[model samples]
Target chain A: MTIQPAFQCERLCIDLPGAPGVRRIIEDLDLEVGRGQFVSILGGSGTGKTTLLRALAGLTSHSSGRAVYEGREVRSPVPGMAMVFQDYAHALLMWRTVRRNVALGVEGRLRNGELDQKVQNAIRMVGLERFRDEYPWRLSGGMQQRVQIARALAMEPSALLMDEPFGALDAMTKASLQDQLLAVQAETGATVLFVTHDIEEAIYLSNTIILLKGSPAHIARRITVDLPRPRDQIVTKELPEYLRLRHQLFEAFRHEIHA
Target chain B: MMTAVNAPAPAVAGGKERPWIFHAADNVWSALQGLLPLIALLLLWQMLGDSRSPYFPPPSTWAAALIDRTNSGDLIPAVLVTLQSVAAALILATSLGVGIGGLIGASPALARCLGPTLEFLRTLPPPTIVPVAALIIGVNETMKLFVIVFAALWPVLLNTTLGVRSLHPTLLEAARSLQLGVVARMTKIFLPALLPSILTGVRVAAPLAIIVSLLAEMLTLMPGLGALLLMAQRNFNAAEVFGLLTVVGSFGFILNAALAAFESWALMPQGRT
Candidate 1:
């Protein structure tokens, strides 16, 4: 039996209001994300990668074509999908404690004790049990981002859309968060559509990487990683397969820049 | 990395700390320090003033007059009447301001259309509005309320509108993605996010409400502290006039302090630090 795709979009186009008239941001794009798969869209700055992620999340309206989620049209945000934003400071409610921020997504749906349990479990999953009662503003940037992720996790979403969730963090924090995200994805089996400008990060975390290029950007290439699962940061990066993929991605990015 | 390497030394050796009682005493001492200037000024005035002078009665004479009024049951009633009017106006103003401001703030087109007219009306002085209100409502409780509400409403309305407009777009996105209904979105999201600004607006409006109510009472010869002050001044009762002035000033200060306390308490969850 063939498994159905979690999200599918065909000939998707988006036009934003600009200086003179409308400017096309995404043009004639086609993509599909499979169930329980980690897919990353890699592109340089101004390639509309974030816009495509927003479109998939139903936050932005496409100018034409259709975006379907499990055969249902996605015109607005659906309950079964959660988005993790890059700017955790603005995305996470500063007034709420770590556990309370995590509870934001599940508060209306869950009851008293059940809500508390889910919030605590989510916080523990992100290794923030000690900081659960503290405010988000008091924590470091990486911890704050974990709070946001824990919030998404508490929603019990079927799909997670992340827009460069760790782009602001330092190297050590970024590596640690990347590993944590992989572990969470493995445990939950949630389909992830991640947008990132980092090529190595895309290769490191994603099962499939979609390269976007050009003025009104469209998918230039799709590369699948057949590397073994339960990958390590030190061990995985040193692999011959990982090195080959990195070289290929570098060449592809350089080609797009030159073109 | 350098700081990280050196940070552990302090972490390992950190033991020196002050006792909780010392901290509490320090706070009390600092608060008392803030009142020293006012205490010194009052003492100097007491020493320099003449008890017999009609123009410059001593501080003791003002205290005696205050005690006399309190005993005769005039001052308390006058203060209660003024407080009641101000309180009523504030409730009305807050309700109208938040409602109208939220509506205008949510829509850019509405904000643009009403912006100029609201700006002009907001700049009109409270004394000017008091007479007009008296002319229309005839110097009653309703007229005093109208004047106070009109003067106090603008700060709240403008601040709330600006606050709502400046809310981070990501919050709205999160609310939408969570599939929150209108009521849930308002109470859980919008109101909590806009609370700090709303409290700031209330802080500004509270003082204005008291001042406007007092001004209205004095202008219309209404039975409040303002009228008492005017009557005392006209009768050349310097002690009573000064006492009433002190009372009014103290009342304004107390109201401001109460609102500030409320703001801090309500916003405590947000973590001021």
Candidate 2:
């Protein structure tokens, strides 16, 4: 079945101020994301994977090109778009309780009872109903990232942007969060553009993987995941298809490292 | 690395039957260690004043005078006056310092441009300005508050600027991605992020507040603890001077403790623990 483009980026470029002069971060990038699809952007450090996601969220100002979302030009982050950052400890405000953090995603922008209901539902969805009153610092790394995901989900955004959301967790925690994130994305059916440096993670979670280059990041490659949904952490990792995809992505990363 | 030393000292309770006696010994040992410097100072005073100098009084004589002052209430009023000056200075300095600090901190370009000039102003000996302040504002409460605010504000201001600038990048990105407006971002993210640093700066500035308040009063001959100390000096009341000095030191200690308690309590609600 054909799907409409949830977002389209045309020749997007980013120039950042530097010590000597302005540095070009990204130049002339084009991409498209379909509704309910999970897209991953993979890049080495200094490549503009995160920057590209930020541009999509309207948090970064591009020197050129356009990010069209649902036939509208993206200029600022609105209800239709939401972002989850790396370093979950800082992503959620230390001062806000878990419930309040989720509430913050929807409150004042939505009707009163509806906002409350959404917050509750998101909390339950994240399996953090028991910790609704606890602060972000009290949560484990994986749990805190879950709260961040829940906050994004609570907004009911059309497209979700996640930048290495589980990057700070231990390996075990990272695997667990990967499953939980895929589950959430499946349940919500929100289009996702997630960025990461881990090649295996990119393949395991993404429906479409976009590779980025450094020193004025440009699209290096694109790979599609044809794996079945409702994926399991243990079974999925052991599968032959998963192993093949992992080897392919790792080879690509190895090339970048060699370069 | 520290485990070798920290490993259950026999003196710790619940370790052994002898722990009660050892715990008492430990308390006494630490208390004696804290008092070692005071004991040394007293010994030096006694040695110096062994019928040779009028400038230095023995610790026993200072203690006697301090006890007498407690009975007489004269020292009490003088101490109270000094404390009041410190309080007033602290209030004025905090409000003005934090206000100006927040303004400068919010504007990084302005802070960078004016920081050196502010540093120069802060480095000037605060006492030197007392006479100028006296001439302009006269030797009044206003002069004392002015000097206190002027002299003590730098640490707070600089700290605040540093605090605001020290915001975690993830928090900032979160705020922006959440679609918070500029004013909402400032109130929610900037203020909260800067609070710890602001408290640290205020802690650093507390002693400055006391020093400037007393310095201003002494230079301008205002009726505060500094003037009281000066009066004691002129009368050659060595014991009274020592007594007043002790009071001033204690007051500074108490004020700092209070501020520390407040800092801990305020930050506690934010899950700082």
What would the per-residue lDDT of candidate 1 be over residues B205-232, giving only the tens digit for each residue?
Answer: 9999988888888888899999989888
Q: What's the distance in Å from true for residue A5, model 2?
A: 2.6
lDDT scores in order: 0.87, 0.80
- What TM-score should be assigned to candidate 1? 0.93
Q: Write the per-residue lDDT of candidate 2 for residues A83-132, one digit (tens) a residue.
A: 98888887787888899888875676788888889999999888999888
**Candidate 1 off by > 4 Å:** A255-259, B1-32
TM-score of chain A of 1: 0.97
Question: What digit string (tens of lDDT, one per residue) describes model 1 on residues A1-259?
Answer: 6768999999999888889999999999999889999999999998999999998888999999988887888889987899999989888888788887898878888789999998888887799998888888778999999999999999888999999999999999999999999999998899999999998899999999999988898899999987888989999999999999999999987866586
Tens digit of per-residue lDDT, candidate 2, span B1-273: 011243355443432223233334444466558768987887887776643235666667777877887787667776777788777777767777777788787787888888889889888888888889889988888888888878777777888877766677778778878877777777767777777877887788789888987787677667777887887888888777877787788788678767766775667546653
Compared with the true structure, model 2 gives a TM-score of 0.83
Model 1 misses residue A155 by how many Å?
A: 0.9
